[model samples]
Target: MDTPSEPGQPTRLLFLGEENLADGFRLIGFEAHPNPSPAQVEQILRQLQHTHDKAFVLVDEALMREDIPQLKRVRREGGRILVMAVPSLQGPTALSSDVAERLAALFGTATLRSE
Candidate 1:
């Protein structure tokens, strides 16, 4: 498990998603911003993509549906940023299903089970 950095250190992990999801990350010590609009998410991505200390960005998959182009650009241009789409509190969306399929293909086995 990764421990939180000491005070004054640049943030390493960031979460932008539903309030409930963001709160979950906050509880784990990540810097989290809840319920940002797509535009706001884009702005934050632009600002943080170049920051040397930024490592990971966890965003709600549902939110990305509104601004996929921006997300793609960030993924393509962000040399070190690991942008991950996560399911919201409401449960899995199309993106999650796609991801699961891709992972299953990659690993040659079922990666997720449907309820």
Candidate 2:
């Protein structure tokens, strides 16, 4: 689990997805990583989990399908990290229904749509 950020510190926003997705977030001032592999995502998440700052991670939903356990573990252990699985530029994956339900339950919102 990560330590909490100091009072008034800016929360970090990170996006992990494809090149186009990373580029889109980068244009909006967010730090983005273009990682399509689940192994790489797991490694990065492990490293980021120990940082003493608030982290909002937006990941490609498709990749999440390949490693649901890793994503679940991160959500279970990451105190200062919030992970959100979002659709890629190519659109939502076939696992959208399951992912959307879980995300909605986690965040208590029904605004997330696969389409």
Candidate 3:
């Protein structure tokens, strides 16, 4: 027999990190899943793509060592998802990259500053 869905269920947000982080997200009413390894992250993401209402994925930079390549492929295939690489509790924040400089060089916006 099929079961009915719950109407007020909170939307899911995947968080691949340490247990502490997971517990923190849960305190605020979010469904946080932990994955500290690349293999686990890959498997969880593949499975989550089908079930659970995942709005955004928060992957730590360390996990990116292997997960990034796989994610790039998913993006290239036009997957309708937003995977934001975030910082682990003991790691640096995302967006601290030289890609912006490279982008600026390519688009000539290096010196375009805002006041």
Task: Please give, for residues 4-66, the per-residue lDDT of candidate 2 as tens digits.
Answer: 568788878888887878888999987888875777788777766656667798887677667
Query: Could you list the CA RMSD of all candidates, in the order they appear?
Result: 6.4, 4.9, 5.9
| TM-score per model over all chains | 0.69, 0.70, 0.56
The total number of steric clashes, by the backbone 3 Å criterion, in model 3 comes to 0
Clashing pairs in 1: none
lDDT, candidates in the order shown: 0.71, 0.73, 0.57
Lowest summed lDDT across 10 adjacent residues in model 1 is found at: 91-100
Give the winner by lDDT: 1 or 2. 2
Which sequence of candidate numbers ranks them by TM-score, best first? 2, 1, 3
**Which candidate has the highest lDDT of all?**
2
Stretch of 10 with least lDDT, candidate 2: 91-100
Task: Sort the predicted structures by lDDT, highest score first.
Answer: 2, 1, 3
Q: How accurate is candidate 3 locally (lDDT)?
A: 0.57
lDDT of 3 by residue, 1-115 (tens): 4333345754466677667777877677655766556666666666655553334666655665464555655444533345665556664343422454476677766343322
Q: What TM-score does model 3 achieve against the real structure?
A: 0.56
